[model samples]
Target: MIGLTGSPYGSSFPYAREGSFYLSGYKGAAIWFAPVPLFDHSGVVSTFRQLELTKTKFGSIIKLHLLSLALLIVFSFIFYALIWKLAPIPSGAYPFVEKMWPLQATMETIWIKSTLPGGADVVGRLIRWEYISAGMVFTTLLYGGLMVLKAPPLLFYGLIAGLGTGAWIHYTLPTFIGAMLGKFYFSKKYGEKRWRAYAPVILAGYGCGLGLIGMAAVSLVLIAKSTSQILF
Candidate 1:
């Protein structure tokens, strides 16, 4: 129940996948269960023996974790230094922008809502300009984090996810264009009255066609890459 509902930051309900029931909470916390026995009687005893051996090695484990944490801090500092060095030197443009009252007020509001402690309730609203600013900030941070860690693009959805409603603007534009075209076509082919109902359907169909084509192109690229690697 705690795993299912308590950890709202990033929690998952207990779910069955393959032979296991998996539950996760917050960041890296997780619990999993396998219904089927993973080991025979002898194997279970061997596992117990291995557990006993682990007790004696606990100090080594602690040392290894500390070393890993130290390395992570070192790498983070290095990345920060590199980013600072590579950053463009500020020009007179900074002072020019700073003097603009409207722009300065807007920047102050964004900074306070984003950085300060309070304003959680306001920010939690479904839609707001604050959300858009937060999205942009998070996306930039995520990109830098991925670069530092040299992680895969498997979490590419994260970039889109953070953008909230803004992410759909591109997709929405195409659909709107399709809807306009559909309205005209339907009005001409059927009747002016019927276009209201049929116009949206055309856009839906148009969007689906585009999505399928995109998926197919991506899949073909992945398949070709895999096939080449296998052959070589």
Candidate 2:
């Protein structure tokens, strides 16, 4: 709406077209950052998400925040339990947990600061069902493995989560660069008067091109898989 990433609702300058819902702009902004780690990364993004949450219905906002807090508590407990069970972590447990507590508390503070109105029905509807399903499956498998088999916690986090973190950064970097380049080029060419109007167009073009390429890639992969199965 305003950059490579969509702008928030009622955003200033080239104001985004109003959607049917009040949070439509906020939803766009959230989805724009969906590729990145939700809990980690830039404070700016975290702050933005908090702002976006404010567009949700008051009741639904409270519920979503509570749900997030509960999940965090459960994850913290699980991680601590795993640490307790680990062969070599007994001595380091206190220091590790102590160090992590501040971060956890800060996240809680951010979550609590958020407020919303008129967003109950759409609270969880923004995210795609497939993403929710996949997240559930992944969480179940990871926890099941850790609890049942006692897989090393570091191994799970380091390999899988680490890769995911890297992938999201990689996916987001190009778009960010494109937006910056657009800003520079537009400002230089159009001068102070008109640059802002065209900068966002560059970001839109990048997203559209990437979307087409991604779809084509997925289509090819599906076709190849089908053909291989038929041939073999």
In candidate 2, what are the lDDT values of residues 92-135, reduced to their tens digit?
Answer: 43565667777877643333222233334343454477985997
Top-scoring candidate (TM-score): 2
Off by over 4 Å in 2: 1-185, 229-232
Q: Give lDDT tens digits, candidate 1, residues 1-232.
A: 1222221222222112311321111111122221455422433444456657776465665797799999999987975565345323343323444457667676445433432344432323534668669867987888678878987543433334324332477865774576576667767888887876875587699899999999898557545533423454
TM-score of each: 0.24, 0.26
RMSD of each: 23.0, 25.2
Q: What does the lDDT read for residue 102 in candidate 2?
A: 79
TM-score: model 1 vs. ground truth = 0.24
lDDT of 1: 0.51
lDDT of candidate 2 vs native?
0.53
